[model samples]
Target: MKILLMLRDEFYQANPGLIEDAKKLGDVRILYTDQGIAKDELIKEVKDVDVILVAVVKIDQEVIDAAPKLKYILKHGAGYDNIDVEYAASKGIPVTNAPGVNAQSAADHAFGLMLAAARNIPQKDKEIKSGHWELSMGTEVYKKTLGIIGFGAIAKAVAKRATGFDMETLVYTNHRDLAEAEKLNVTFVDKEEIFKSSDYLVIATSLTAENRYLVNQETLSLMKPTAYIVNVSRGQLINEMDLMGALEEKWIKGAALDVFEVEPPINHLPGMREVVATPHIGGATFESIKRIGDLSIANIVKLMNGEELEHVVNGVHSRVTQR
Candidate 1:
């Protein structure tokens, strides 16, 4: 069996052993580039591979067509938006992601972003280093209304963390469960209500055609001027241009983002103290990467052995998996 592992150079360096571990199962080809692997080269690399493992590179119809022999596609982490699961499903090429592996890590990042944006943590630190000791007024998270966009694993984890801060979490999901809300001590609310009521808003929903740019002009208008927005999920979930306008016009006080519309966004988003940006490190914790790698490799092995797979997103029950 042959496998193609496409990852960022930094991620490969941090978890060097994953390649070696995958080697135990098949003829593994490791590909790395600081920027996502170029599509032309990716096509060449995947043409003959039986399985493909990905980080942030797009696995669209073109890439899928090139990988005629591909039996399975594994997203290195939870978010599979980078992969075209629908097209792969049509081709009988199963796709799976390491779902809960990075839940705690991403949840922690989301909460940290809320605190950093609300309290001007990064801004204050920069100001102090520059010999400006003036105290910047900041908001508190204590007893604040926290609005979350989705109730997935990471969302649930973030909600649980809010308990320690004594936050009131209002959740908005397409499919809501009253019993689940009661158990988690959160309230079910409409999207408009979440926007208008939250002191701090978090974008935790998965990116999709239906909800792309979910946070835009209309929603920003609903938020309080003192409110802050935190996003550790996909960048496309919030419209960057709209968000920048909102920040410039002071529609919302601040924003903290781990992902952006473009990775290493060409223009500095916000370009001010109010926005704290991290280079998509929500799932980069050492522990979380290891967990993601382990689960990913286990699924690859299951596919190779033709066993039942876990976290299969495309529901590909049977396929002519080539070796």
Candidate 2:
């Protein structure tokens, strides 16, 4: 048996123990590249491997088809959107991710962005560093309405922290699980209502085809002119062009995003000073990375030993057997 670990150099540098753990299961092969393994690269690297571990790399149908002996795929992070789920299911390969691994860190980053945007912290710091003392008036989070776009673990953490600021919380989820909503004291409302009523609208939803451009012109138009938007979720959820238009037109006061439609290209937007942006570092903390690495390795090890995985994305299949 063999396991191929595909990850960036940073991850490998942080968690050298994963390589030793993989050696216990099989001959371990490491691909320390973040550009993503192309189909041919995946084929060559995983040809004789029994398992594959990946992080932030696209695992499409072609890659799955190339590795005939591959049984399981372990994603280092919570989101498994980069993997082709239906195709992996068809191939009888189970995919698993480290859910809630970075929830706290991501929530903290979300709140940090909100605070920075609300108080103009970034602008003030920049001005001071450039030899000026401009004390601009900023809004307060207390006694304000906070609209959360998703009710997942990260959103729950955010809601918990929001209570400290005495902010009213409202949530919008597709399923609207009332029992869960009650626990957080968060009212379940329609998406439109959340958009219209929120002073600080936080986007924490997972990325899916149906809600890809959910925050386009119509939704932005409904928001208050003084409203601020913060997105720590997938960047594709908001249409970049529409967001740019909204900021330019002052449809909303501003936006603070840790993720963008085109990552690293976030700075390319004209007049981006109207918004605050980070380089998708919502889950980049050292603690979060360690948690994710440990969980991902554990999941893969369990699957290799014919044990149940902690966060299986696909239903149980008998295709993978321990040798």
State which candidate has the highest lDDT. Answer: 1
- Highest TM-score: which candidate? 1
lDDT of 2 by residue, 91-174 (tens): 888888887888999999999999999898988999999999976999899979999999888999999899899889999998
Clashing pairs in 1: none
Q: Model 2, residue 217: displacement in angstroms?
A: 0.5
| lDDT on C-alpha atoms for all candidate structures | 0.87, 0.84
For candidate 2, give the lDDT. 0.84
| Residues 178-293, model 1: lDDT tens digits | 77777789998998999999999988878889999999999999999999999988999998989988999999999999999988787768476679999898988888888888
Off by over 4 Å in 1: 318-323
Q: Provide the global lDDT of candidate 1 against the true structure.
A: 0.87
